[model samples]
Target chain A: MNTLQLDLGERSYPIHIGANLLAQPDLYKKHLKGSLTAVVTNETVAPLYADRVVKTLESLGQKVKLIVLPDGEVFKTWEVLQKIFDGLLECSADRKATLVALGGGVIGDMTGFAAACYMRGIRFIQVPTTLLSQVDSSVGGKTGINHPLGKNMVGAFYQPQAVIADLDTLKTLPPKELAAGLAEVIKHGAIADAEFLTWIENNQNALNACDPKAMEHAVRRSCEIKSQVVAQDEKEGGLRAILNFGHTFGHAIEAGMGYGQWLHGEAVGCGMVLAADLSVRVGLLSEADASRLKKITAALRLPTVPPKLGINRYMELMSVDKKAEGGEVRYILLDGFGRAKIQAVDDALVIQTLQAAGAG
Target chain B: MNTLQLDLGERSYPIHIGANLLAQPDLYKKHLKGSLTAVVTNETVAPLYADRVVKTLESLGQKVKLIVLPDGEVFKTWEVLQKIFDGLLECSADRKATLVALGGGVIGDMTGFAAACYMRGIRFIQVPTTLLSQVDSSVGGKTGINHPLGKNMVGAFYQPQAVIADLDTLKTLPPKELAAGLAEVIKHGAIADAEFLTWIENNQNALNACDPKAMEHAVRRSCEIKSQVVAQDEKEGGLRAILNFGHTFGHAIEAGMGYGQWLHGEAVGCGMVLAADLSVRVGLLSEADASRLKKITAALRLPTVPPKLGINRYMELMSVDKKAEGGEVRYILLDGFGRAKIQAVDDALVIQTLQAAGAG
Candidate 1:
């Protein structure tokens, strides 16, 4: 087991990574300092692991409540958030109550957002059940639900007290979902760590097989990289946007296809390929390097071609994405595998990419 | 104009208190860095001040969008927030869009919450039209909506870029509403400043007459004191909880009777009176001090006693207030007129207060 601490002074917290960390009762009991606990999960993950989490928390004599939301990205709404509030209120959860987000990115984001708004704010933990959540969303403190109009439109930058990423939980995740998560890991490598990218290429199969050590290392490294970035720029004022290496196009794809049609990470994987292709077009990425990127993503069974469904839909959806600043489209472009910068790409580039996706 | 700054680093902004601050076109123009400006106001204030504000902002060559929400606390809900989002999308307002909260607490809170959620937040300025909003809710970054289950159950602590408290708007406010706002001013005196308390006592009647200079001093002093406290505890982590003086019981009075039935300040006025009496019982205040408090509140035409309502209803509403930490029911107890502290008061005290309200 390896652990990394996000040193944000008072808001600083620890992230634990191991295959069986879920069984370590102390991981939750020691860090969770409250009278009541609400473990928020989704319908999909609940049948598999909810009982294990509840039993562990209950053994510590912490009053626990379970709130099971619908299992998809589209279900993240104000109505669903109300169910979380109802669970807390019905259980008499107080301001000191600790919320545990016990599933993947959807569950974690909605639960953390609930904690942020429940009683105006409360303590919460991330018990992420998927690779994408463990590596990316859970640690950054960006919690929100999608507006029918846009994704992550309503939220707060509320940091969690701790993150418990149990790799054992990822054993049940389908290979397609697993491949989707690799998009973020590949993003980490593409934006800042060429060595990590090389390593991921070498160990791609090990991760797909859910090898405990390799999966744990990837989540830990991704968290370490993310924590360092967030500690410096908690609000995406700068540097942190690099974390959105594939997210600009990814959000457009997600919204254009409708939120749940394509899982966030699935869109991101295909979007990364498009962004890399675009980077090459702009003379920042080498064609050879882009091919290597495509080979690795394809090997993992992740999408590598630009999706054709959302070419015209891009303008409307991308307009409201968080990445858009000053009414202009800002893309996180790669200068190389380990260097990325936010750039205002011309409409010609965007149109060409959409055309490429349409023809593909 | 006397200005007070809530110095929250990047989130910090100025609170300008005086007559004609609204007419100063520079106030809106300075923060209008981006191309789009969306002004949110309620129906009541729009016909009077909307054109003037729009004129000023438009003269600066910024694209302007105006959204008028129904004017009342009942309208402060997700439904109204959706309307704001719809308006923003209809006008193609994007991330760089600046949201100007162009009304009182309801408009400001709903607008701020909308801004906080619109593209994960944008620049917002509080144009507080009433005394309650200008002196209190406007300064804090706390923005949210009432839930059927509870008041302010969903929200975000999003700070504004600036707070414009144009006292000129107070001239249009009703006498009863104006008196309701005085409760907050009296609260500022009760919790922190001894001399300010003395000043309010001496000139309470003059303030009732709408003396602009006295109103300026009151608003400026209240903000300065709140600014200092907020700087120390931005999230009600500790000292900031003291700002909720009378709010615990006050929230109950408002929510129990249904919000806006008793104005926020009116409920707080009565809540303060009860708190002072309870403070005497708790040995933190003298009988004379309690009596003096009641006399002053009554002189300002504020309620000295909560409405004779159902006791159980009050209890249920109070439990749902976001301030009840750990289910222990923390209360903001006044040590006297110029100092306050947060303490876990006995449930017996809360029950007694509810019983008293029922019998009043």
Candidate 2:
């Protein structure tokens, strides 16, 4: 078992990664403060792992309640998030009750948000089942439901008690979702570690085949890079903007295409391509490096071509993004192979790139 | 104007108490970080003060958007809170946008919670028009909407950039609302300042008449007491629970009667009476002191009798209160004239107190 700690002072928690860690009651016992525990998972994950987690908690004398939400990104909304609250309230879950989120990114995001708001704040644990969640969403405390206008438009920076990522869960991930998770894994390397990017390039087959050893490295390295960035700027005042390297364009594509049409990671994967192209146009990166990043993105079976959203619509979606300040959409561009920068570029230049990329 | 700083380290903010402070653009100017500002008020307050506030912000070069929600606590639900989000998104309000809560407690709470969740978090200033909000909700940063099951069941402890309490606004308040505000004033004196309690007892006529000087002192003193408690324990881990002095029983009355039937402070006023009775039963407070507190509550024209919601119903409602931990309802009892203690008492003893208070 490998454990990584996200250092957020009092809010800091551990990330446990290994095989069948869900069966280990000790990981949960250390964090839970109350006898009542609510396991919040979606329908897809509940049928698979809810029993294991419920039995483990019940064994420790916890009064367990299973709340199963519908599975999908489209289900991430205020109406659906309220179900978790209803379930908790119906059972008279108090401030001391603990919530264990057992699902992928959608479940983790909604559960973390519910924990942040339920009783004005309570303790929650993240048990991310999908590769995308294990590598990215589960590590950072960013949890919220999406508005119809934008993705992740309403949320909180609430950290979790701990994150348990069992590699065995990845054995069941669909190929598309696996590739979506790789988009974030690739992002960690593309923005922070050149050597890790090269390693990913060298081990394409190993990652594609879902090898345990390769999956472990990808999750660990991605978490290490993310935790370091988050520890410095938990609220994203400045330095943390680099972590949203492809998110500015990715959010635009996701919102423009209507969320759930393209997975977040898939949108981010293609977003990295556009961001790289913009970075080259703005004289921040060489054409060679841009192409290299694109090749690597495509190598992971992720989409590289931009969606067919027109420039005006794309610009409208990007302007409403949370990253935009004072109506100016800030683009996260690659400064080099392993570095990123946040700045606002001219509309003409952005549109030119969008047109060239077939997004116009 | 009198200014008191709530020392919350980096999250610290100033509370300004005086007449006509809301019309002063400089107060708003110093805290606003962006050009776009949203003034969130309710229908009752909009026609009265919305134009003045919008003109103030506009005078300071801010493009103000007015979001008017339905008045009353019954509207303090997720469905109503969504209107604020809709207004912000419609205008493309960004992370840097400032939200000015321009009404009483409900507006302050919903706007503050909206600011806390909008784009993960943003800045907001509290322009409390009601005395209850000016003295209590605006200072502590406890913001949230009510769940169907309970009042304030879901929310966040998000502080505002500044609290602007205009004493002049109190002149327009109805007689019933003025008395409701006095309940919190009396509570501030009872829990933290015996001298203030004595002063309130002696100056009932001035408070009841809405005298500017008396209201100023009451607002300023209450902010001082609440801010000091919040600074020590911002998240209600321990000492902060004492600040909820009468809230446990008060919430029960509010929920049992259905919200909006009794103004929050009115319910709190009556709750204090029952809590004092319980404190006397527990031997923590003298019967003489408890009677004195009840006399002061009644002198302000606030109700001292709790509605007859049988003991079982009261127990059921209080158990689901945000203050309850692991199904144990922790009651905040008066330790003496100027202090409070939090503990779980025997249910039978509590029932006796409720029965004596005409609540059973």
Residue A115, candidate 2: how far off, in angstroms? Answer: 0.8
lDDT of 1: 0.84
Candidate 2 structure quality by residue, lDDT tens digits, B196-254: 99899889999999988889899999999999999999999999988788888999999
- lDDT by residue (A1-360, candidate 1, tens digit) is 778998888889999888787767899886676778998998899899889999899989888898899998878898888899889988777778999999998898889888888877888999999999999989989998887877887777788989999888888998878888888888888888899999999998898898888897788889888888898988888898889987887888888877888888888887787788778778899989988987887877787665666556676676777777777878888898889988888877877866776622
iRMS, model 2 (angstroms):
0.9
Please report the candidate that would top lDDT against the real structure: 2
Off by over 4 Å in 1: B349-360
TM-score of chain B of each: 0.97, 0.99
Query: Candidate 2 docking category?
Result: high
Q: After superposition, how far is residue A351 of candidate 1 from its true place, in Å?
A: 2.0
True contacts kept of each: 0.77, 0.92
* Model 2 agreement with the true structure over A1-360: per-residue lDDT tens digits: 999999988888999999999989999999999899999998889889999999999999999999999999999999999999999999999888999999999999999999999988999999999999999999889999998888888999999999999999999999999999999999999898989999999998899899999999999999999999999999999878888888888998988888899999999999999899999999999999999989999999999998898899988888888888877888888888678788999988889788989998
Candidate 1 lDDT tens digits, B211-318: 888888888898998899998888878899888888878887887788879888898999988888778767798889878888889999997777766666666677
